[model samples]
Target: MSEDIDSRRDDSGATAPAPRVAVEPTPQAPAGQAQPGPEAATPGAATQPPFNAGNPYAAQTQTVAHTVVKTKTKKLPVFLCSLAGMVVGAVLVVALIMTGALNVNRDAGTATATSEPSGGSQTIKIDAEDTTLAEAVSAKALPSVVSITAWSSGSSENVMQGDDSEASGSIGSGVVLDTDGNILTNNHVVEGATDITVSLNGESYEAELVGADTSSDLAVIKLKDVDAKNLTPIEVGDSDDLSVGEWVMAIGSPFGNEQSVSTGIVSSLYRSTALPTTSGTYIYANMIQTDAAINPGNSGGALVNDNGELVGINSIIESYSGSSSGVGFAIPSNYAVKIAKQIIGGKTPEHAYLGVRLGTVTASNARQNNLSVNEGAYVGEVIAGSPADEAGIKKGDVVTKVNDEQISSADSLIIALRSYDVGDTVTLTVQRGKNEKKIDVKLGSDADAQTSQGEETNTDSAEGAGNGMSEEEFLEYLRELMGNGGNNRQ
Candidate 1:
């Protein structure tokens, strides 16, 4: 419960909801491509991975994977980190109950309410007799997946002097969004990068950063020196149509290996977790969980269905040895596209904000606190003049639902809020003592909340550092700060 307040206050830069998932801490390669060294450490910092003295941009090692784990009985410690050259950590807890039916039903509602892409029209129906399903999908989707390399210059003056040694870079993957040369990848992949290069079909071109949103861990980069006509855009799909046990393919670079493909099944859906970083806590809600072998350098890669249609963005993985433990997560295409569009439109990506401290409702806590509900989001503190306070939501209120969606725990509440955008109106069902009441509150923007509260919006300005720490040092620090155990692959 104390951890809940520490994690959830990020809505106002005070505290925010923490994430769960236990793997190991490992740095993400630029495109899931293999670097010229042994496996790097996971970003959760459970254990330190061997550092390659030759490669300064090696992945950091740590314990737990990058996703936060929440159970009805307890909330596990979240060690979610970025998988890029910077330490990316997420935890994998097998204790999670696979909620397939719940995800399908929830996503069904999203499909009707949101104008997401229906890739059914573009889904390629291949005759299994003619070729294997993987072969067909790979042939169609291979052109749409590209390898990305993000370079960070040590000094502006040194970069101008053509000092390549002073520059550090990481590898990750990207999905071609359009023929206009727009590509979508994880923000962590490109964060702190001054130079970016994209490799497509064995050709390389320079790219420019369009924009980034740290809260959602999504970013858009545009090719600056490439011909749009030569680009092949990937067919987008409706992620709300996904079901548990469905076949999916992960295409990306792992350990600098470009255009690699791995097969797996959708293990779970609607997985909500957060990665607390020096910049801020990244909320990964309503995610697609799969058993695909997502490894370091697979960040920003493509997670497609058998039809070669893009369904999600490969982002994080869970492992204890800084390798794949058959637990990986992706951002659903619907939400990823929504955030990407906002960045492309030159708008700062915003997350819905409900200014209130949260604690998970559990049997022990409920009994100790004399609460009626055993499962729900218990309000600990409400920020003054914030949405929750403005709506007359009092402390100790147990939020059970958001509109038709049931809020089973504090994490669920965070996940539900993510389904909505800033300025959207939502009806929150609360349990006060034995009385139940519904409160309508217009959601506010986290960006606005930060501004009003005079919080730092710049990611580089975090951790009392005016200039952000280098990716290499950041990973080392993450391993130490988070803990020294488990080695995550991504």
Candidate 2:
């Protein structure tokens, strides 16, 4: 074999190829026979000994990775469920806010705010003149106004016996005219009174009667045990300056409530009504008419002008019964102040009287009678020996004016005459048969007229048949006859 290999490598030191030797074939083992060799004994061979049989690290590592992957994959659904729960919770919260289910109370808070609002804008601004006038009047007048209560016996007789009669209390208003506690009120308030009390700012005090004038329905009372400190006197205003539809304010006790205030305009001026008094005498006079709410307790209250000055005293309400009928009457402050001064001075003031039964000359009556003076007071009758009779005033004359003041109607004449007193000379202008004549006549007292009528009963009765006396005149004649101590009438 070596020689042959050397011959093959002859030209370039090449070794000869090995000779093909005829080798015997190896014994063919069965397909399942175990092989015996170093090849068979390798680690991965089936016949090899197991070197790492006790340890299964490789397989265990693969098993552990697969388990970790499966466990991670299983957690996705849990995470998704948790996220859906959070979304549901957020949606519920949003729905709750969308619906209104809250409660709030406002009136409970307002009840606690007791102080009035002072900083708001005013609806109307008071002018300097108006403010000055109000300040000047209100500063003094508020303290002068007082509330009065008079308790009277209900029994017509035995009123002085306080124990036998039922007590009925009346509420009214008053004005303090001076610093000496002299207060002015209506006569009707103190009439038949067993007890009288005055109140100011919620304080009560006893009042003593100064005097009373039944004809004018006025009375004066003095407060006891009180000094007039800080008392404001009401400013006196001229009623003559008052015009119809002027703004006015009424301050008084209305419906037994004190310090009640009402405002209205003067509806009419120079009004007249015959109010019946407790003494069975008629108070025939002039008054101012207003639409202000004047209840039963508002009598004697002050009717103030827009300047807050005293213009009139609330006297009566034109009602069917004892309630207000939207027509309130007030006595002019001119007359009230005059009567108050007289009462304070201890002088009994007498009312001026013109002894004549007068009626308004209506348009129809003026046209039918062809009267010389139209729209004037038609003198129906004149008392004998009276002012008109003494001044040569005839029964057929019509009064057109008194003392240069034109009498638009009978009411105007009456209002004008109220300003004068007894013994005052008044010039009367009368028209008779197209002749206007002025007659100067002295006024007499109302008492004088009553005395004169009392003395003329039989003469009036004898002339009643020839005078075309109506039923009302015949009744008046009979009343006068009875009052004059005539034996036939009673």
Using TM-score as the measure, the top candidate is 1
| Highest lDDT against the true fold, candidate | 1
lDDT value, residue 484 of candidate 1? 28
Task: Give the clashing residue pairs of candidate 2, or none.
Answer: 5-15, 5-16, 8-16, 9-14
lDDT of 2: 0.63
Once model 1 is optimally superposed onto the true structure by TM-score, how far is the C-alpha of residue 15 displaced, in angstroms?
24
Compared with the true structure, what per-residue lDDT tens digits does model 1 show for residues 1-490? Answer: 0001111111112321233568887876789665664676554456556776887887765555567887663333232222432332212222222533222222211111111221211234444446677888797788888898887766434655888687776788898887678899988788888888889999988888998877678999999877765777888888999999999999998878899999999999987765555555566788899998887778899999977788999887654334466888899998999889888777767788888766677677789989988888878777778888899999889999999999866655766788787789999999999999999999887765544434544433221101122344334433433342422222
lDDT of 2 at 258: 77
For model 1, the run of ten residues with the poorest summed lDDT: 1-10
Model 2 C-alpha lDDT per residue in residues 54-134, reported as the tens digit of each score: 686644321212224343467889899999999999887677667634222212111001101111111223334335544
Give lDDT for model 1: 0.71
